[model samples]
Target: MTTADDFRALHERPEPFLLPNPWDAGTARLLAHLGFPALATTSLGVANVVGRTRATRAEILANVREIAEATPLPVNADLENGFADDPAEAAQMIAEAADAGAVGASIEDHTGDRATPIYEFGLAVDRVRAAVETARQRSVVLTARCENLWLGVNDLSDTIKRLQAFEEAGADVLYAPGLRTLEEIRAVVSSVGKPVNVVMGFADPSITLEQLAEAGVRRISIGAALSRLALKSFVDGAREMLAGRFGFVGELPPITELQQAFD
Candidate 1:
């Protein structure tokens, strides 16, 4: 059984773990075949697949259960913002997530607002604390996300300060999604001594995976890059066909690939 213990063990490995986010069963199985130590579900991808704007608590749990049942790899549920307005409600959702077979999960501090993107600091900490307490009962590893960088706060010192508080509040992993610079990443990794998850796709140039590992990043994730890549290919190919560039539509994936995917 791929239990929470298995997910916890990945962190103890010497090299920084790379977990690709998958939305559906096919993607999950492919990731498992790729020998990933674990897999994570992307909320945006799930929402898009289901033709919904966002995920409800019920929908996310159902999806988590489906992905967990489809693969043996430890599955990490991206429980976006905990899916609740109240801390207690969020904690309850975390327990439900564990029941659905999530080995671990993340609770973001983003408010989904452009103007005021992140939650109030104190409330965010309380929310993370609630999630940790709930997950502790099931031994579900809880990751706390600080969205300051993603929201363009761009203050490394403040980001470290918040993450240190999250670590104290019982987060097993500390993540800042938009951190691109080595200095910011190193500072966060150094400040709390907790495993950090950085987004693989970065703007204004980026540090390589090896360099990030040296800089002390313990995990790397490509949030929705795969989905974007797939969409880009489809859109670009259609545009070429419409513009009488049929020859440009070269050989796509083999039929065997699709058959095996469903098989």
Candidate 2:
């Protein structure tokens, strides 16, 4: 299968595939070595690495190109809000991402303003349509994300309606982050009829993979959770060193092992 087909097939599996989000080339290579079928770049993770509140399109595209070239597995970019308020500009950015070697990408409906968090319904659908049409030209998988749930909208019906519109707008995958219940997850998955991606880690820790699969989720991603975990380790180590303790050094992976993975 082609790279695009291979990435698309991961969502078609009977069991939901785990798509870990990696922030950089090192993390991408390490995750690929661990045998994940595909990797998605975390916008938060990349922002943290670059010390930016949010990464620019140029920054994200550079990271995407690096990770895509660093591993054989397909890489999906978190192209948050398509980096533009205009639909045509958003569509052009999607095409640029495809040209940078991302087999898959996501466009979210978040409006970047907490007071008016999500885009208006019609405009959101138009944005997804624009992104999808551009992605289709490059044979890229486009995942349309409805930010309602995460933006405090808390309306499952509205979220599902947006997802349905996105599906009809030609999104290959549907995602509504912050869905907490099995019923909520299943509702969106059933309503969309396309592959549904659920973001894990922020949800209840007790929810198992099987539970999500049973809810009909087609793919799972841990958006920035891994990056946060890594940062926690570093912070803890630094704290111990400041206290004159050296024990944290013992917890690190051997340099040779990291070198081998990178090689």
Candidate 3:
């Protein structure tokens, strides 16, 4: 089966599968070595790759290629907002992402403007529909994300409404990333017929994978959580260096263990 086919099938199971995001090829290989079934590119993580606040199309797709080629596992590209305000641009971005080796990708509704963070409802759904057409041709599993809940818009009803429209637009998966409670998550799941992907990075750590699955989540992703964790460790270790100490060394895995994991 194709990578896209494999990726789509992963959403069929009862339990929610963890879709970990890797920042680059090394992290991608490590994740594959650690036995993750799939990997994804994080837009913020990719920015860390080029030492920029946000990455350009060329940079994003180059990172996508590197991560996808690092391991045999399918890679989902986080093509945030499809990189443009126009629906055509979003469609083009999906096509380009597939060519770069992503079998699955996401298109969020966040406009780049802070003054108007979310796209108008009509334009948002139209963008999704445009992306769906391209995804259909490439057999990429497209997850339509509503940024309202994640972006401080505390309106669940509108979020559900947007996701429902996205589902009807032929998106394979639906996501509203900032849900905090199980009730909110379940309500989103119950609102749509397509598979729902939840980002555990935004939820309480106390919430287990089982609880999310029980709440009817199909796919659970850690968007930039792993990247942020790696950053924290680096910062903590750097502080130790400034303090003239080697104590943090004991916290890391043995070199041999890391070598074997890479091998």
Of 1 and 3, which scores higher on lDDT?
3
Poorest lDDT segment (10 consecutive residues) of candidate 2: 198-207
- For model 3, which pairs clash? none
The parts of candidate 1 lying over 4 Å away from their true place are 51-53, 203-206, 259-262
Residue pairs whose backbone atoms clash in candidate 1 = none
What is candidate 3's CA lDDT for residue 45?
A: 90
Best by lDDT: 3
lDDT of each: 0.82, 0.89, 0.90
Residue-level lDDT of model 2, residues 1-263, one tens digit each, is: 88899998888889999999999889998998888999999888889897776887788898889889999899898999988878888888788888889999999999898888899999999999999989999999999999888778899899999999999999999999998878778788888789999998656777899999888889999999999999999899889999999998787789998888898
Winner of 2 and 3 under lDDT = 3
- Clash number for each model: 0, 0, 0
Tens digits of per-residue lDDT, candidate 1, 1-263, equal 34688888887777799989888888888787767888888887777677676877778888899898888788888888877757888788788888888989899888877788888889999999988998898889889998888778877787888889999999999998888778777877888877888877652345787887898888888876776676687778889888988754466768787667557
Q: How many steric overlaps does candidate 2 have?
A: 0
RMSD of every candidate to native, in Å, equals: 2.0, 1.1, 1.0
lDDT of 3 by residue, 146-205 (tens): 999878999999999999999999999999989888999999999899999999889877
